[model samples]
Target: MGKLTDAIKHLIIINVIVFIAPQLLQLDFTNMLALHFPKNEHFGFWQYLTHMFMHGSFAHIAFNMYGLWAFGTPLEQMWGRNKFLFFYFSAGLGAGIIYTLVNYYQFNGIYELFINAGLTDSEVLSILKSGSTNDVRVVNAITQDQFNKITSLFNTPAVGASGAIYGVLVAFGLFFKDAKLALIFFPVPIAAKYFIPVMILGDLFFGMTKYSVGNVAHFAHIGGALIGFLIALYWKKNQFKTN
Candidate 1:
């Protein structure tokens, strides 16, 4: 909205650094910093926090940082640095955990199908890891589509601050419910209260269905919004007490 506050400035600087440093140095931080499937070998505990700073592409980081600055500026100004930091990180962690839980459910459902078809644990793991099932029984038990989904889920690592940015967007909506906003594709301005819920619903619809536009982690966005809403609600209700 105006010049960045201290926390907002520092957060943007860190995100930019994380985005640019690896490319400049020709270093790969995907396995170490990007969030991966819990069952994947490359999965790391620290990625839940670190992945918030990692991004897949320039457009991805640009959008996220812009959201952070645009929406986060008011919140940081209202809540001050420490409180804003707590809310931001809490939403991000919630996003990672929720995303992982959803993946686990889907992965295990497919895994159970494999087990029910008489494949052993090791055999199922082997098939998932190798992305091939020569055994007639395994092939007949699960369709190629199912095999591909589980494999892609296992191998594709999630990066970027979209989750945290989604959290900021939600908070912005709550704080400035009447503020006009619009998406790039749909530029007609709408009140934040109306627009944000629609946005989140779109994510939920895409996350549960097969129509997701890109390699987006929709559930992460949902998770962050959920956490942001709860925290912002609590703070709003207890505003006098906190102050």
Candidate 2:
């Protein structure tokens, strides 16, 4: 195997361990590591880093690891391990910040909608805690009563390496702007410079459109790309003076 960046390699190994932990050790640690939005009572400060290693499903881990291997090796070679690691974590953190803010606003909007419909304090609290509308049915005898109280406070947690991957995507586009990469499942080859921006734009459009199958955190992807692009620009400008 070619020499891999320490940080990237470490991250990959951790993700693999976590993904298989439940299957091998019979421990469901994803719930503990996944980053819950700030409104969640269970949220902890460490989740920002831990969540990057947690994946919701096999496809999630596979896709993320594939992207990391595809883009990160070249990035580490170009930027060195430390800088690459910094960029990766920073982008992931930025994604979490953006996702939190957006979720907060959405929660508020939904809260107001429920209040307008005459939901009481207890009722409102219930909806927020459970993360579901009145239309959604509550299951299980134990949670039935607390359903309304918890729903209001309930915020869906985001878990994945997508943010970091997006950072790598941005780096690939910026450094290899003219390099051509072919899309899987499609035979056509497209330049990285063109392909990456198009992907960002498409995410933004669909994110706003609220299209079905658009549950993916498109803004988080955009947030990571934006931060990555800015960091790359700064590095480019300072390269001569620093070196």
Candidate 3:
């Protein structure tokens, strides 16, 4: 295991503080800092950045901070603090943007269905806000599945550093393609080049399908990996290094 680099150390510290401080203080920061749907009342432009520093639970922060420390140490060592910070935030921001875009698409698609079925904007908003519809017309306008999806899209907030850490994993793979890594579920060691792509592919498959196990923001992970791969590939091709 590599020693904690400067950037990764500070990041983990911040994450820990953010995770614990709110609970101790009996304050909730989710509505203010977590990434919410664009149409949601709680959403703000700054959430794209702030949400990276927020985490949902102890296990969530633990897993993400571990990934950051493990995979990001080598990256911060290779690219100086400034460059590493730039890359990390870039990937995180990309993840948020891509995630929002995907949600917007889904929201709009269902919205059009409601509009085509002759529901007014106010009626649609009421249904979303109240999570119920007394009007049979509104009920007939959209299926239960569509209603559930749209409700979840608006109500659920995305919070964590997983996106940034996913980027770190990609960079690690690029820098140490031969490095062997294994997951808890699958303990067999595999080279970074092979493992990272397969992991990302799994995220993509889960993101596109309804078979995902939990409340995973799979698209955010895929977005981070995509941005990280692009940036790392460009740097590799040009032989770029911060130091």
Top candidate on lDDT is: 1
Task: Give the lowest summed-lDDT range of ten residues in model 3.
Answer: 129-138
- Ranking, TM-score, top scorer first: 3, 1, 2
Please identify model 2 stretches exceeding 4 Å from their true place.
1-3, 116-122, 131-155, 240-243
The alpha-carbon deviation from the true structure for residue 56 of candidate 1, after best TM-score superposition, in angstroms, is: 0.2
Q: Candidate 3: list runs displaced more than 4 Å.
A: none
User: Across residues 1-243, which tens digit of lDDT does each residue of candidate 3 receive?
Assistant: 477888888988998998899999999999999999987889999999999999988899989988888888888888888889999999999989998999899899998988888888877777787776767776877789988899888889999988888988999999999999999999999999999999999999999999999889999998888898899889989988865
How do the predictions measure up, each by TM-score?
Answer: 0.96, 0.83, 0.97
TM-score, candidate 2, is 0.83
What's the distance in Å from true for residue 145, model 2?
A: 23
Off-target runs (Cα >4 Å) in candidate 1 are 240-243
Q: Compare candidates 2 and 3 on lDDT and give the better one.
A: 3
Q: Please, what are the lDDT tens digits per residue for candidate 2 over residues 1-243? A: 166667778989989988887789878765578777665667887888888888888989999988888888887877777888888899888877776676667557555655565667576565566555535332322244344423532555678989878888998888788988776776588999888888889888876663727247777787777877888778766772221
- Candidates sorted by lDDT, best first: 1, 3, 2
Model 3 residue pairs with clashes = none
- Candidate 1 C-alpha lDDT tens digits along 49-89: 99999998899989998999999998888888888898899
What 10-residue stretch in candidate 1 is worst by lDDT? 234-243
